[model samples]
Target: MKEKVGKQSLKFENAPYIIGAASVAGPKEIDGPMARYFDRVSEDPTFGKDSWEEGESEMVRQAVMLAIQKAGVNKDDIRYVFAGDLLGQLIASTFGIKDMEIPVFGLYGACSTCGEALSLAAMTVAAGYADNVVAEASSHYGSAEKQFRFPLEYGNQRPLSATWTVTGSGAFVVSDRESEVCIKGITTGRIVDYGVKDSLNMGACMAPAAADVIYQNLQDFDIEPTYYDRIITGDLGKVGKKILTDLLKMNQVDISDNHMDCGIEIFDNEEQDTHSGGSGCGCSATVLAGYILKKVSSGEWKRVLFVPTGALLSTVSFNEGQTIPGVAHAVVIEHHEMSKGK
Candidate 1:
């Protein structure tokens, strides 16, 4: 009956099923490999809005509404919405869902907001606090560049290490209703700093945190790396992917065989000319909603360790020459059949 597992983890006795999920992506993403999997795609980067920020809000709104509709649930039936975006004051999310009138919890874990939101949603539903809830995260490439790096108008040359921020939003309807996939457990991560101050190179900043959490999850569950069919990371791109595997290998926990990075999967580095890859909250969120869940639901991948990594840094902190610390949260997602016998 004990839900508390090991340090920094929880085993839910009543795992919440993901009744519905949706992904809304932008123009550039529409050309990517996973484009066909997205529920909604727009050729306009502004999403018919005047500004990039407003467009991002529209994406969030569309995603949440679509997810609710897919779940076949009335908006009033949902008890809470855990959502966020990579914007100051969470303006994107606030404006996006304010009119919905659902109780809301705005979260910010940089690009890892999706994982954080999902983890909290699972915990809340597992505790019998609510019958249904929505967890979503969004990020806009134009908005992110305006806030973090230089403006698109500046026409600055990005380094090869730089990653393109995804312009999209993903939402999930987590409820007590039985479904094809569910959240089994979670392993929360702590902020870890390697003192790397490169604002452009997020892979270097986040790989350490991803490695730490994945290692802890394996140890806490007393299982090997192969316990999950695939070990997924948020936005570690190519450079960070190498660093993550190398770090885990040092601990004798190798996930190289099944390791997959959302950043790497979202875009084709060569044709898209996206430099390293995609990096943003939407990167992992959309991938999970559009692609990963399908595989799990089809029983192609029975279980997956979804770890979304975040580089904790603001323009203010980066301008002050602060190191970009990283954090990652891991959610155990499995097929319903896998949990049936247990």
Candidate 2:
């Protein structure tokens, strides 16, 4: 008789898995001939304007509600809600989930909020502490520009590396059931400061942080490039993505075509003229929630690694001449075979 290796177990007794995800946009609220200018003050003439004010919590709420509905779960069933935005104090996320009646945990990871929130949500379900959890992030051009770039009337010229703020929101629900989509693993980034001089260019500021975490993740998991189907980076934009590629190569890791950046993929970089490309909480969130999740569900890919990049800097801090610190959180999403058809 063949020797039995310990007891073979097919069942995975984890907390739960990611069942569904959804991303909602306010119909491209601000778009026009002069929308490129940061100082042009014009109301976002859109349908959801009443509830979707710039930098308001309503947008986040709408996205979360839609995610809950898509997951086929009631809001009351969610044990925990992890949400965040770039706005001060994360007011958008807090107020958005207020009516859900679930325990809400606020977070601020700049553009990386989505990944951070998702990691926490996955942990909650994986640890058996929550049956269902939600992670969400939102950002609006009008509000983000005013807070980070310039006032409506300032009319300041943007630098070549500056990124545009995306107006949208994305959310996901994790539960205790086998599903087509699942969270495989996550690597949290350590706060890194390289003493960069330029604050306006976020790519240069956050590249080091992304590199450190990505390296650490590879080291910890002992995973090779061929092991994963895709390695996606959050909002590092074109400039930062290039830097990261070179850095990874130095460590004998080669990720070329399989590597993608949410900032560059979200919009038509050439046509949209988004400077270095899109960078914001919504950039990665919307792309993953709307596009990637659907593709994963369709069985096009088996394993995916998501690294959301964040530039931990504020206008107040920048004005005070403080160096910008950066962080990135890596989350692995995969398909669970046993949970299929359940």
Clashes of each: 0, 0
Leading candidate by lDDT? 1
What does candidate 1's lDDT look like per residue over 1-342, in tens digits?
Answer: 588888988889999999999999999999899899999999998889999999999999999999999999999999999999999999999999999999999999999899999999999999999999999999999999998999799999989999999998999999998999999999999999999999889999999999999999988889999999999999999989999999999999889999999999999989999988998999999999999999999999999999999999999999998999999999999988743642
Per-prediction TM-score: 0.98, 0.88
Candidate 2, residue 300: how far the Cα is off, in Å: 1.1
Model 2 agreement with the true structure over 34-60: per-residue lDDT tens digits: 223211122442323453343356667
The parts of candidate 1 lying over 4 Å away from their true place are 338-342
CA lDDT of 76 in candidate 2?
Answer: 86
Assess candidate 2 and give its TM-score to the true structure. 0.88
